[model samples]
Target: MKNFAYTRAGSLSAAAEAASAEGADIIAGGTTMVDLMKIGVRNPDALVDISGLSELEGHEIGADRIRLGALARMSTVADDPDVIAAFPALSESLWKAASPQLRNAATLGGNILQRTRCPYFRDTAYSQCNKRNPGSGCAALDGGETTLHAIFGGSEACVAMYPGDLAATLVAFDATVATRGPGGTRTIPFAELHVLPGDTPEIETVLEPGEIVTAIELPVVPAMRASHYLKARDRESYAFAAASAAVGLEMDGDTVRDVRIGLGGVAAVPWRATAAEDSLRGSPLTEATAREAGRIAFADAQPLEGSAYKIALGADVVAGALLQAKSRMGGE
Candidate 1:
């Protein structure tokens, strides 16, 4: 809603150069950025419209990885034959996000970079939100039931979950994010993109001020076809998840070979379940094993006062997702 200067970038350097000024922000689809600005949470003196840079578009599925240009549209990736056949979890995750209209305009990079939807984080109507204004104190504690708050990797200062549907799937797939910045281009594991709100909840990602997202890369996942992403939200449409899981499995007959699990809605980040995957690897794909894997995923979860239900819900989400993924694998 605030008046601001806007300019398009010709290339990656141009984008970074345009965004180098203090209080400057990049606009891809302008979905989350514009929303944050409307709430007065973001006040960019200049808006670098990177949407015009065709250099940051398209994807290439190579022998070992899929290179995703930062500007590749969500709808385009969701419908790609290779992504559909191989990275079913990635494709399903995108299609299951926002509305079709939103997906049409939303880029893969933008989807992963979307901000948390915590009431305290997004509501400018509220006077105190540590995320919007650090050290202001979180009102969700005494004000209302914060059932949607994070359960993992939260400090006493903040408990807002990192909210994005596609991001969870990307982390599970071991995706890497490429960025071009003031220093030079750098690659970071997608799982390392988000930083916990230890003291500063205002800063979400590790990208430098002048760093522009270039691409996201996913290494080959042979078990990707035997994958699934499921969300238990308030409704079947136009909603964020309440509890969700992204799962992929490789098997030798009924014996699990490799398993990857990632959870959303319960963590400050898209939480990769190393314990659950370890429990399932080299084990028989039975209901009991699946249940154990799910439970192990939440063994270290620390829930808030009013949101203990997430531990059980998160476990069930992982279990259900594993079962569904195995069923699909059986069919294959």
Candidate 2:
């Protein structure tokens, strides 16, 4: 890593101000930031340590909502009894992400802000990654290692997938992100936090410079008790998802009362399958209906030569997740 000035911010205000400095980056769990720094993908001249800020260190689980501190470790959230009981999708997402050691060190805030696992973006050896270097051109589109690339939200500029598990489940649950910036604190829908590559792949997020995420807020989701997150990968442990689904369903006997679906490892952002949810609403929760919902979810997919298989794979993943979630609703 490059030599950089380090300072610990005593308060959120102080952290915000410090983060505004040129090439200054915030360091919380240091899982994503440190790895990017070491790989030369991110070379911040200054790192503002915010891990000591007690204001963003714990969680608040209420009957109506759940507020997860940005600094809360992934393992901590996964192991919380309240989270496990009320939000099974959220708990499962964290538990299935990364490895046990990484889960213990990764923070909720950092995980959402984590960059794409695109090899071209991480290895500076590639000279054509638009995300790493704007207007430089994207090699992944023509390079042929696109099995892991996006099939839903891709443009000519970039096709990289957003590699985040928690954000997918949070999007499924209609979560909001709390952030502190130079102007003050504000809350935005979690879905809007990540921006599509479009023409400007370099600008990954909507956050203004110097803004630091404070917490992730999830509204009370009664159906979330029957939710589940299932990931399909090449191997089991320590492998990134090829396609994953976070699904929540509320059933009244055989009919679907409510539904939420979020897809991962197949889009530029955490994808909420609203159309799929609409199709499944008020319908019987049967295997055929679930499969149809999954197929409808990928109606707009623009698949590349190598990643076309993901459309079918993604459909099956979503359908299986829906069935799994429904099974959890037994006796409820």
Q: Can you write out model 2's per-residue Cα lDDT over 209-268, one digit (the tens) per residue?
A: 899999999888678899999999999887778889999988888889999999988999
lDDT of each structure? 0.86, 0.91
For residues 145-174, what per-residue lDDT tens digits would candidate 1 score against the true structure?
A: 588888898877788888788887988889
Per-candidate clash tally = 0, 0
Least accurate 10 contiguous residues by lDDT in model 1: 137-146
Whole-model alpha-carbon lDDT for candidate 1: 0.86
TM-score of 2: 0.98
Segments of candidate 1 deviating more than 4 angstroms: none
- Candidate 2 wrongly placed segments (more than 4 Å): none
